[model samples]
Target: MTTPIQIGLLVFPNMTQLDLTGPLQVFAAVPQFVPDPGAEIHLIWKDLTPVSTDAVMVITPTVTFADCPQLDVICIPGGYGTDALIEDQEVLDFVRRQAEGARYVTSVCTGALVLGAAGLLKGYRAATHWTAMDMLGAFGAIPTHERVVVDRNRVTGGGVTAGIDFALTLVGEMFDHPTAESVQLRLEYDPHPPFNAGSPATAPADVLARYEELIAPNKVRRREAVARAATNLAG
Candidate 1:
């Protein structure tokens, strides 16, 4: 019998729920679209305790880091919590160990910062939330400002909602266009926003300005976190 592909997603505190769930939904459907040896998804964390998200949602991890099998794909999703993760040695070490065996080391949004902290993104082209794009340079990564970026084995997504697009892209790469299409169609992943304000480039200047202002404090904290993480990586 063909062994099922192992996929692990890090479900940490304060993560954006969609960052993990969007990809989780996509990968969970792999068996329906593919042959017998399909993917098995695992929600991984330090323990089995329920993890709180940035929002009201709480997620329980199916596997702990020590118990997680070798993964074909290992993903980290991002949120306000990422700032703390960058300097978190235990979390960084766990990710580093997983990436060594994983065929794909991936992230969504500012989770790229966590990967960067693990010294995995050095010299790779990556994508992250626009606010943290410049910070990629600290980790020796080339920041690509697309919705999704694939550089060798490291795949990353831009922002919160880009997780869906990132997962679809991974499905395409892992299987084929038809498989990805099948998954997309199954999920009814059509997006139609009432306004074109999803991105800073497209948003009204005043809206973008207001967002920047709102996130100014976060930006400061993120920069400090990145600096500490970079220093840790350097040493």
Candidate 2:
């Protein structure tokens, strides 16, 4: 029997729930899907220890980085922890290593920052939270303005809530458009932002300005993290 296609998603502390949870829900529903057990996905991490998210969520990883099974696809998701994970020696080391053995590497939101830190985003066109997209250029990525961007094997999603779009796109690539459509139907993935302020272009100038102001502090920290990681690479 052909070994099943396995997906390993590395979850770190404070990972955005929507990042992994969105993909998890989409992929888990695959079996009831289209006779596609080969497309199974698992949550993984550096250690099987408990990983806390934001403030009130936690889950013990199913496998450690060293013990992880071979993966056809691996994803890293963004959250507050992504800022730290991007600089963590152990976590970045794991991402760098696992990416070597997987066919595809993917991320969401600032998770692209982690991929950039891992040196995997070099020469790739990618996207992230609009508020943070410019930093990808700093990390040597071709900045993009789309909700989802894929270059070569590295796929990235924008902001915290784009996971559904990213995962559906991934599922389409892994299976077929029919499969993706089926999943979308089940998810009612049709989006309807109540305020019309989701993206920079759609939102009022004042709202966009407010977003920039709010995220300015995070960018300061993000730049510091990028600098430290890049310096490490250079040295």
Off by over 4 Å in 1: none
TM-score of each: 0.98, 0.93
List, residue by residue over 187-232, the lDDT tens digit for candidate 1.
9999999999999899999999999999999999999999988998
For each candidate, the alpha-carbon lDDT, in order, equals 0.94, 0.82
**lDDT score for residue 221 of model 1:** 93
The best candidate by lDDT is 1
Model 2, CA-based lDDT: 0.82
Q: Give the range where candidate 1 is weakest over 10 consecutive residues by summed lDDT.
A: 33-42
List residue ranges in candidate 2 displaced over 4 A: none
**Residue 47, candidate 2: C-alpha displacement in angstroms:** 1.9
- Steric clash pairs (candidate 1): none
User: Model 1's lDDT to the true fold?
Assistant: 0.94
